[model samples]
Target: MAFAVSILRLAISTAVFPIFLLHFLGLWDWICKKLFPHFMVQFSKSYNKEMAAKKQELFGNLHEFAGSSGKLALMEVGCGTGANFKFYPPGCRITCIDPNPNFEQFLIESIAESRHLQFERFVVASGEDMHQIADNSMDVVVCTLVLCSVQNQEKVIQEVHRVLRPGGAFYFLEHVAAEPSTWNFFWQQVLRPSWFLMFDGCDLTKESWKPLEKANFSKLKLQHLQAPLSWKIVRPHILGYAMK
Candidate 1:
């Protein structure tokens, strides 16, 4: 009787342990969804502001779109919490794309605050598959700090090329693989596995700019930017515009 009872108890514990872990993970994800957006929005404020100025200096052509008689169509992949809304010029319409549906309310609030811009729509779509948007429609495609987490970076760039009208530009800012034999590079590799797991699939050592070079854009330009020491591990970044 004692031996039978011990065997049964062990079997029950084995079965229940997996079930408990599964539920615990699901609950943790739920909590993260509810809280992570606010943290992302807050942490991005200063970085976004500084980058906007530098971006304008690098590609001042965007200013030409301002105050046009007709609205210039723009698509922003991974438009998290609409952090870039304030930086857009007047007489532009924006189409926001993000995989996380939880960001819709935050985006709506951001749109309301942008008096110069018009909100075309928000699609809960990943950058790799922007099928809902019509081809050759967007005048500009903005991708800032986003390529780090995309499942297929090349596919996303191809979609950007496809949706852009002739003379359109794809503007991107992304953290890239650090220089070899450096402390930052070493730390990036060491922390990548765990970091990717914690931070929505963001890989530390992805050479995000390589695919942009392969794409047959009419003009392609890239400039390297130094990240703050506080973010040293993922500090090296590339920013540029690719004209279609």
Candidate 2:
């Protein structure tokens, strides 16, 4: 029995060693970044169509909140491939932020395609610590499909609030934990470890809306719904805006 156990351990170690080596060499993150943009294209098309009305309501009148420049100063944290750029109203001066610098090329392509938006710059920074952005500077903050992968959701929310001007709005769309006692939730739990490993730290079971709820926004409008054309594990989603 002991010999059998040792053999099983060896098999498992051998199977995992390549993954460990990729991570150690920083190639795993690079691979995920390269592939994720392509993978998200179809998902974004479906999600954007389904969520169009809500996004319109959230962003259509953003010019009303514009400062002296007649443009909304918008910042999107974890702005992978700028999937939400097409949703913003015209004349938005947009700054994009993401921890993975590898997404920069894709982001530039997205910016080029989003000609109506004025690209401010892309900052390679994490949402949890956006010290490069000044406090009370942004007119609007946006995050989509980001909270699940952030190392510290609460800290990210805090940073969002800190950077936004008083009365500035924070918009978000994120997949969250499915209801307890459901098959999807069970699978979410079972697959979470491998999902995290394969998808660049996305926790399949994160209750990402809790931190948003507790963030003490002046006004909050959140809706829980199922994401259309999404994987079963990521179907439970939240979409809304909070005013700072």
Give the C-alpha lDDT of model 2.
0.84
lDDT of 1 by residue, 91-167 (tens): 67899999888888888888998989889899999999999999988889998879999999999999999999888
Backbone Cα, N, C clashes tallied per candidate:
0, 0
Predicted structure 1, TM vs. truth: 0.84
Summarize candidate 2's per-residue lDDT along 42-95 as a digit string, tens digits: 667777887777677666666766777778999999998887898888889999
| TM-score for each candidate, following the candidate numbering | 0.84, 0.85
Report the number of the highest-lDDT candidate.
2
- Give the Å shift of residue 8 in candidate 2: 17
Against the reference, the lDDT scores of all candidates come to 0.79, 0.84
Model 2 misplaced stretches (Cα beyond 4 Å): 1-27, 41-43, 49-54
